[model samples]
Target: MKVSAEIAGFMKRLGHEFAQPELLVRALTHSSVVSPTRPDNQRLEFLGDRVLGLVMAEALFAADAKASEGQLAPRFNALVRGETCAAVARQIDLGQVLKLGRSEMMSGGRRKEAVLADAMEAVLAAVYLDAGYAKAQAVVLKLWGARLDGVAEDARDAKTALQEWAQANGMPPPVYDETDRSGPDHAPIFHVTVRLADGRSAEARGQGARRSIEQAAAQSLLAQLEALA
Candidate 1:
């Protein structure tokens, strides 16, 4: 299938013009689209996840000579997480070109973090399939610019760090509560509170999964604690 002018412009923004334009088409197709002839991006997303992980792992390994596996592991997780993938997808405006079913479109699937992240991975796989691993690596490195540089510094999980601090100070473990859940079912917003035994607490709002929201709330509390210290 031929790509539309919009997809052509998107390819320009993505920094890679496809030799086989059909790959790009497949990447943008969501499962909800209901195409008998055309396939969704699920398989491509799986491949892209592995490819992205390898690229990030190699990049981290080369960048940090003395970092232990412990240090590099968290950095790798940060780079390959759904939030990071969604950020990259936003950079390329991938949502604008996504092919969703009527229900999904009406529900704002394009703005969902999980959808964007999955599409981003599929696009990476498309690039890899269209050209080669080298080209895909180049694109990933370029798209993920600056994030790679700062990832090492921000690699530590906020919740984990906060827990360690609490344990070291002989305090009980931090508790997380979902204070509020709002918005439509398709795109819910979670208000999570992270409270410590010492009564210092912070709340944060996050969209998407409850786990991510809780993590965000923990991060907010950790930042507050650090600032007070």
Candidate 2:
């Protein structure tokens, strides 16, 4: 199937020209728009997740010469998580090209984190099918870019790291409290504060879930402590 000018432009941003353009079209087709003749991207998303995992694993292994499995695993998770994938999708404007049903489009489906993440993976799968593993790996690396260099810092579980820091410094565990919450029930934004036994504290706000907000708060606190040190 022939792709439109917009999709061709997306391909250029994605850094791979598809020999079978239909794969890319299918990759961008959401389940909300699926029909008997029009396949969706769920299957492609599944395959792409594995492909992404493999590429990340190999890259991390090569990047760090002395890191243990425990060290590498969390970095892998950070790199392959939905948040990171969605971030990559946004970088390439993948959401703008997503084909959604009217209902989904009305609901702002293109901007939904899960939808963008899934479509990013599906697009990877399409590239893999159109060419080969090497080509797909190249695309992933190119898109991921500087993220690979910073994965070590990004991989740390901020809450856990903060707690560990408190312990190492002979302070009690840091405390996290929700300062405020707002927005609709379906999408609440949480404001959280993390305070140490020594009275040092930091605050941060985030959307999606409470745990993520806590993590953000902890990360903020960590940054503050690092600056003081």
Candidate 3:
């Protein structure tokens, strides 16, 4: 009951409210929220994933009318990915509004990338179901439109984007060296340091090799750029 008010307030910021409020409730419920007959947002998450993809594709295409498919695909992938969505989801404070079982809630499940990202998809699907495709598109665009504004070949990945920006501006591409790795090989936490050619550096962590390198590169490049400015 009270969940409705919270969600309504959230959707207002998100620029759309649900016509059928139950869909929004289910969207905010992780799989941990279960009952004798009803399930959680898993199915809606599945549907929402497709909806998000479709909407993102449309956004990518419309925004980049001149980009080749090969070029557009990766940029599209990066923009709509789990990490990006989870980042955006976290920005919206979705975790605060999510409904989860006590065990999951206590274990930081709401902030988990998979949960946050999937919940975003579920919310997208809920919007779609409530008001159909166009309104859903409007909601998604409002959230991600600025990101789509100037996509290009150089804009493939943010990590890549930062690297290219550095290189073009007479800075060396940041170097990502593994500082340490922990946990099992199958799921290791990598500590990577990003060193600039100009004797500056920074570090960041990521769950896997490519991500670690990218994040480290981003941190170093961002720091250098900020300092220069």
Q: Can you write out model 2's per-residue Cα lDDT over 1-229, one digit (the tens) per residue?
A: 7779999999999999999999999999999999999999999999999999999999999998889888999899889988889889999999999999998988778777889999999999999999999999999999996898878744778998999899999999999888899986546789998899989999989786577788888988888888989
lDDT of 1 by residue, 17-111 (tens): 99999899999999999578989999999999999999999999999898889889999999999989998999889999999999999999998
Model 3 spans > 4 angstroms off: 1-3, 150-152, 158-190, 193-203, 206-214, 217-229
Best by TM-score: 1
TM-score of 2: 0.84
Model 2, total clashes:
0
Q: Give residue 113's error in model 2 in angstroms.
A: 1.4
lDDT of 2 at 29: 97
Each candidate's clash count: 0, 0, 0
For each candidate, what TM-score against the reference? Answer: 0.91, 0.84, 0.72
Instruction: For candidate 3, report its TM-score.
Output: 0.72
Which residue pairs show backbone clashes in model 2?
A: none
lDDT scores in order = 0.91, 0.91, 0.78
Error of 1 at 62 (Å): 0.9
Residue-level lDDT for 211 in candidate 1:
73
Q: In model 1, which residue pairs have backbone atoms overlapping below 3 Å?
A: none
